[model samples]
Target chain A: MQLFFFKSINLSSMEVFFDENESYHIIKVMRKKKGDIIKATDGNGILLEIKITSIKSNKLIGLLLKKMNIKANKHSPDIGICIPKKTSRFEWFIEKATEIGIRNIYPIISHNTEKKKINYDRCKKIIKMAAKQSNNFYLPEIKNISIFKDFVVKKQKGFIANCSNIDSKKFNEIKLYNNPLFLVGPEGDFSDFEIEFAKKNGYVSINFGKQILRSETAAIYICSICNNANNFNL
Target chain B: MQLFFFKSINLSSMEVFFDENESYHIIKVMRKKKGDIIKATDGNGILLEIKITSIKSNKLIGLLLKKMNIKANKHSPDIGICIPKKTSRFEWFIEKATEIGIRNIYPIISHNTEKKKINYDRCKKIIKMAAKQSNNFYLPEIKNISIFKDFVVKKQKGFIANCSNIDSKKFNEIKLYNNPLFLVGPEGDFSDFEIEFAKKNGYVSINFGKQILRSETAAIYICSICNNANNFNL
Candidate 1:
């Protein structure tokens, strides 16, 4: 069944509607008409069984025939990373991370970041598509690109990765904590000054593994480690 | 320092030469001149320090000055997966696995797979570029596309993943023994007959995680788990 996204889909009510983009997809591209069964979510935990009520060109208003089971997001640690230089690479990370059950993805922009602007709308669409394809109910939180210093100082248990000679604890070696955040640097990586600033703050320095991974690669790897560690019983 | 790939490099005498591809990239793209220091690798274990000898339009030959280091590929468990439908998707999996230290990659062609032809040259080039870009000394062994049944039965330790009601063991739940082999299915996934056939031939059924991942996502996820488990005690 086709899945649609709506911000405030009230399952208690039998009526539902879609955003302009999603309505266009269903009405024009998918050619869905009245009485067509489909699925929808409110970007929260609510999953609804909706049937097309009417379509005015690209606008799709539907009837919520049944309320599907409310599903919770997976229990993996959240990973907030600095967006990479390439948009396709960043989108690739989002797709894979959604499939692998990453809770949150906050795209941070750093000083050495070559790619500054991000297409937030495009990224959100990719995440939604990936979530539906993977049969996952959770859509990871994709935040707007923030500055390095501001992101590092956020109120969350964070880890900063570096290539310096400073010894850092391995990811799996660390104790698992729920809703953890890993800040990945850009292609040139975080500058020394930025690392010092992060250190002066509460963020701890950590090594993902033995290999030197790319910015996007490190993001996915660290996300996987934290995710598995949470589910893994010692 | 810039890095270049020389397939015809002879590691025994520390002799490494650049062909048109490497030469053009170094001279025209990187704007490197004579006497410039750079690093070159054979996509094997050998790393060489080369000083530019002659800068020609067609070829920029370099003299091997010193042996920097011959770093061996990390001792991680081998993972062989079926070639996915999209060429770029398969290439993406190879890139991520190579960065995380996968020893071998066997691109199997399953019965239900939509893609039949494997672009070995293009895929290997991507792997080599990703390996060098990730500062990896060794490239994963890229095997030719083979039949799933033939490859699994012949391998020592084989596993197949499928969407069944059976609750298979999670990847990290397993103990490490020999290098592991995981057969990831295509878009439609492995057929029921294929699953039963693999099971009869001594292949164990295992799940990557709770979420349903795509073929490429599953391949990279499983490789990370196997490598992490193999190096757990170290």
Candidate 2:
């Protein structure tokens, strides 16, 4: 069944409206007609099976027939990556991260971060598309780009993955309550000063492994690890 | 110091020849002349510090001043991923996995795998480029694309990661003694029969995480998890 996006599913009337852009896609691009069955999610926790009742130029009305909530509440890594040199690459990170089930994504501007200016709106769109494509319930939370120092001050369980041989504590040993954040630097890696600052703030320096990985590769790796942490008997 | 790739680094004489390809990159592209110093790796386990001496159109020779084997020799994951829909995406997987220290990568043909043809030489080149870019010494071993059933029967500690919620053992919990292999299916995932066959052959059914990921994304995720199993403890 084709999937659609609905902000909230009303149980009483079983009616929902899609965004203007998405409505156009359904009526014009997809040629979806009335009584056609479709899948829709609120990008929160609601997944609904709906049938189109009416289609307009900028709005589509649907009757929700059945509803199911895909519970996405779980312990997954919140990987904060320093923006890359290209915005497209960074956008690619958003798509993959959403598919990988990242809980939260923070775009940080570190001393070595190559790309400073980030398009928050575009990044969010990529995240939504990936989420819908993968049939995910929750969308990854995107925070504004903060300076490395300010980000390091957070008291959350922290880890910094860099290119240095600074033997880091393994991910399993760390106590993961609910949300654990892993910090990935840019191509040049976090500066010596940034590492020391994180060290002082009690952010454990961790290596993703032996091989040196690209900035985006490191980010995806950390996210996968945190997501899979619960499976391992640590 | 900039890093360059040389075919071989002589230990006794501490001399090496930069291939015509690399020679052009250094002498013409980067505009570096004789007497300049740079770092070079043979993509095996050797790192060299050299000073430029003779430069020609066909060859560039450098005198090595110091030789050190700073290669990181951590455990590697022996996993194989099915060739994805887009050949370039599968090629990219080989590149990133090699950079992240994967031991063996095979292009398997499963029920849902799109691309059947395997270009052994082209895939090897991709791994080489990634190894050089990531500054890693070891090159991941690439195997010819094998049939799904044939490949599963030959390997042990094999895992099939799919989209289903079938209970699976976490990677870290599984004892990885010898080289282990995991078969990642394409975007469509493995057929029911394939999964049953793998299970009968002692292959464990696994899920990378709760979220649904793309084929290439799943390949990189599994590779990172298997390699960094020990990293979770910290």
Candidate 3:
């Protein structure tokens, strides 16, 4: 069953209205007619089973048959990482992270991989598709690009994954509290200054084992581990 | 230092030779002339630091300056997954799985995603590149695409990850004696027949969590968990 995205729906009224763009997709693209059954999520934990009731004035209207809330109360990982130079690599990271279930994703410009810009619309579309594909109702917020130094200072504390191999703690040994934010480094890894600064501020250094992984790979791996942790729920 | 691939090299000979294709890459593509140093691995366990001693007759020859073993002795998860329809998706799985460290990789043809033939050369290239990118010396062996029933009937047992919520064991709770093989399902998940057949043959059903993951994501997630396990090493 394909899951569609509904930005907003009136649950109490038991109605759903698709805008011009979505209407075109439903009517023209998908050829969904009146009485067609469809499932959609509002990205705010609400999943609605809707039956297309009317198509008028280039808009699609439906009556909500059922409503289900996907509990988003679970404290999952919110990732903060330096984006890779390859657009596909970074996009792949976003797709996998969304599928694996994350709360928020922050693209950090570090000393190594700095000043990389990500298209917000593209990221959002990818996230939406991944969520729909993976049956995840909670849409992770994509934050604007932030300087590494500024991000660390502002977030205060989290787990930073690096390749320094100095005083690094195994992932299993680390104490995961609520809403853990992972700070993964770029290609060459975080600079000495960046690591030291984060550590001083309370970001514990962690490694996903001994192998050296790509920036995007590291980010997704972090998500995988977080999703599988005992206390966590996706 | 760039990591190159050596299909076979003699340690006692204290010399390295690049074939015609590799010679073209070193001399033309990479623009590495005599006296230039390079690092390579035999994709078994040995990493070598070699210095270009001669470039003659379209062959690149070097003297081995250093030799180190990557220790392939540690047991790790060997993944057998039904190949995804997208070539890039399967390639991504191979790359991430290699980076995260796997003992062997099998692309299986199952009921749902049936008989998808993977390009062995392309997969091997990706695996080699991933191993080099991750600085992993133990290159994972990419096995031929095996029939699902034939595979289960032969292998006898492994952990099968599916969307089915039946009597699943948490990954941490699963006993990992050595070289645990992970069978991850395709997009729609394994056919009920496949799951039941495997179970009858001793396969334990497992789920990653609540979220449904892509076949590639599930394969990579299994690798991540295996790498972080206490007894495993990359």
Candidate 4:
């Protein structure tokens, strides 16, 4: 099954209008014809079954036949990661994280963070494409960039991944939290002071394995493991 | 401890020579002093504890203080994946698979295989770097590109991930194989004939999840899950 994403859906109108990108994709690219049925999500957990009513030059109008709210994945973890300097690496992380089912993404800044700017528009587009391809109804929110100092004050209860000497449990060994959040450090890793601060704010240190992982790779690992441990709880 | 990769190791000499890349990284980037102890892996399950003896412009010399054969991970899976056309995607797959502790990689070509060519040297370098970063002593073997016809004849017992209608179990639910081999298809996916042929050769169908994944993403997902399920068999 394929899924398309729309930014918004008006319940009162009972009609779906394809955006410019989706219109071109549905009409010219996919060659979807009028009266054809298709699935679409509003990226807010609403899945709509639409019957194409008209395929104009730049617009493909559809009548909503059915709509249902998708059940949110209870095990999806929120990932707080130091944004990498490389755009490709961050894009790859966004793609894989969406596929692996992430709840929220915190593009954070730590002591070692070199790149503080992100192309939010491009990132949202990538997220939308990934979510559509992955058939994920709920779009993961990309929280505004937060400095490690400010982030620790939130008192988020989850694991903090760092390549430092800290008494820790293996990622899979830790008891799953209700709303798990994983904070991954930058290439240089979280400084001793940052690690201690996070620890004081109720974040427990956890190790993915013996080897060191890149910031983005570590976040993906945490997401993958969280999905595995929670979705297939045996 | 950070791990470096060496192509080969000599037991008799009890001496180690760092190549230009390693020498530069050790001497320039990391700024190691004389008598500094560093770890090196030959990618053949051997680990060397080396002590810096001399440093030069393009050469770093070390004495092998100790060497030992590391135990191999018994549960590492062998992945047979159709090569993606994009260089970055293929490179990303190699890096992540090595980090996830894949035993071997077979770059295969199926009915829909588009790009048959691969830069073996570059891929090997990526594997080495990822293994070193992940502290993996054993390097994953990158087999020559095998056609699906020749690949199916091997009679490997493992799983094939496809979006076709096949009676399948969740990857975690399926009993783990001794040395798992996962065959993932290309963008167009394996043809119906190929899927049946693979089944005849003892490959079972397994689903990663409900969502569709890109070819490289699927391979990485399989590797990640295999590592998680095996390493944390609790």
**Per-residue alpha-carbon lDDT of model 4 for A131-231, expressed as tens digits?**
98878888898889998888878855768889874687666677876558889998888888888888888999977665577877877777776666655
Q: Which should have the higher TM-score, number 1 or number 2? A: 1
Q: Show model 3 residue runs off by greater than 4 Å.
A: A23-37, A73-75, A230-234, B7-13, B18-39, B49-52, B57-67, B73-75, B170-172, B230-234
The candidate with the higher DockQ, 3 or 4, is: 3
What is the per-residue lDDT of model 1 for residues B33-61, given as tens digits with 9 covering 90 to 100? Answer: 89888888776776778888888665877
- Give model 3's TM-score versus the native structure: 0.90
For model 2, residues A1-234, the per-residue Cα lDDT tens digits are 455677555567878888887888778878889999888887787788888998866689899788887766466678889999987668777888887778888889999886788888888889888987777778888988888888888643588888776656554456665767789989888998888789889788866544667888888777676667655533
* Docking quality level of the chain pair in candidate 2: acceptable
lDDT of 2 at A224: 71
Mark the 10 consecutive residues where model 1 chain B has the least summed lDDT. B68-77
State candidate 2's TM-score: 0.84
**Best model number under lDDT:** 3
Where does candidate 4 stray beyond 4 Å? Answer: A7-13, B7-13, B18-34, B54-60
The 0-to-1 C-alpha lDDT of every candidate, in the order given, reads: 0.74, 0.76, 0.83, 0.82
Error of 4 at B71 (Å): 2.1
- DockQ metric for all predictions: 0.48, 0.48, 0.56, 0.52
> Candidate 1, which segments miss by more than 4 Å at Cα?
A1-40, A48-75, B6-20, B23-28, B31-37, B49-77, B230-234
Instruction: State how far residue B211 of model 1 sits from its true place (Å).
Output: 1.3
Q: Which numbered prediction scores highest in DockQ against the true structure?
A: 3
Check candidate 1 and list the clashing pairs.
Answer: none
Write one digit per residue (lDDT tens) for candidate 1, span A139-171. Answer: 788877788888777743577876654756665
- lDDT (Cα, tens digit) per residue for candidate 3, span A31-143: 88999999888888888899999999768889989988877635578899898888898899999999887899999999998548999999998998898788888888999
* Fnat for each predicted structure, in order: 0.51, 0.68, 0.65, 0.49
